[model samples]
Target: MAAGPNEPKSRYLQYLEVVTGSLEEKRRYRQYKARVKRLPENYRTAVEALERYLMHFGPADGAGAMSMYEDLADLFEQSVADGTPIRDIFGADPVEFVEAFMANYPAGQYRARERNRFTSAIQRAAGEDTGQDGTDR
Candidate 1:
């Protein structure tokens, strides 16, 4: 039977039951790793690092998630088309790449709370925020 508009799509529903450490989750992880292995080493590293960053700070909404993925994919495709080496593009600095990517989004595109939290986390990581109160010590 075809799913109704209100019903979850099959591809999305497949992940709904994925439990951490479950066989299904492990299978998905393995598949992802195998696919990533086919990319050039430098590109592979950059992609993996970006994945990690997004896992930590990605959007919660479907629209935001889709937009983020599309933007990142476009950036990677454009870089490849320009004949830029991945290592040279990311420059052995995942944080710098992340910062540059984040800069592309205008302020307030994300939820205010999430945006503030992400900004604070980045500031702390950069050693720009020395105190819990958000003031330099």
Candidate 2:
């Protein structure tokens, strides 16, 4: 079993928890949905649309995904309270907005090991030797 979020664990154990799923994560998800439901209709619709996109393009790790969702809910809830327009929240480009938002959660997509593999593969295909640090040698 994985340790609770408050408990310290090895990275490998954390990875396992993400892959296997956790009850706490499920509970947090329920709460997040409920919070979204409480938003104004327009905000709810906008949040749902962003959520649909996030399901496909956001974090891969369960904890990271949940944290992103929780924060997203918080942001929208606060926005609704502040009477901020949806366009103002995400700006002109939703994709850019999401990408920028996801940047804060580095465990999400194109993780470090995967990024290294991708870079190394490209270097090999180009007949170049990449240093362990990923620089072209």
Candidate 3:
């Protein structure tokens, strides 16, 4: 069969693979959300309230949990400077507020893994599976 104007049939297959992989990732996040839903009433209330005033100032990195810890720390400082009202912000105590909120925000470990969810997809699309020889990025 003749290839299309945009690319070969192989490219389409790679696109579909990446898309399906992403969908599976969404399901994982859904499970995580359900668990979060089960948190204690007071904690849930606080998370909900703080989430309503969400803001993400630093780079998400979106490719592994520890990769963005530095970025997450920066966001915390920015959050405080933006007058996020620590008392009303995080559900944790004042002593643990900084570390607690930094860990809870979308900048958490789960979120970090979620960010890297697409790296393999893009790698596969670019034919990088075999020692990343054809990978562009």
Badly placed stretches (over 4 Å) of model 3 are 1-14, 17-21, 49-55, 58-137
Question: What local lDDT does model 2 show for residue 20?
Answer: 69
Which one wins on lDDT?
2
TM values, all candidates:
0.47, 0.75, 0.32
Counting clashing residue pairs in each candidate, in order, gives: 0, 0, 1
Locate the minimum summed-lDDT window of 10 residues in model 3. Answer: 58-67
Residues 28-52, candidate 1: write the lDDT tens digits.
4555566556666776777778877
Sort all candidates by lDDT, best to worst.
2, 1, 3
Best by TM-score: 2
TM-score, cand. 1: 0.47
Q: Which ten residues in a row have the lowest lDDT in candidate 1?
A: 17-26
lDDT of each: 0.62, 0.83, 0.47
Between 1 and 2, whose TM-score is larger?
Answer: 2
Name the lDDT of candidate 1.
Answer: 0.62
Q: Residue 128: error of model 1 in Å?
A: 23
Order of candidates by TM-score, top first? 2, 1, 3
- lDDT of model 2, residue 105: 75
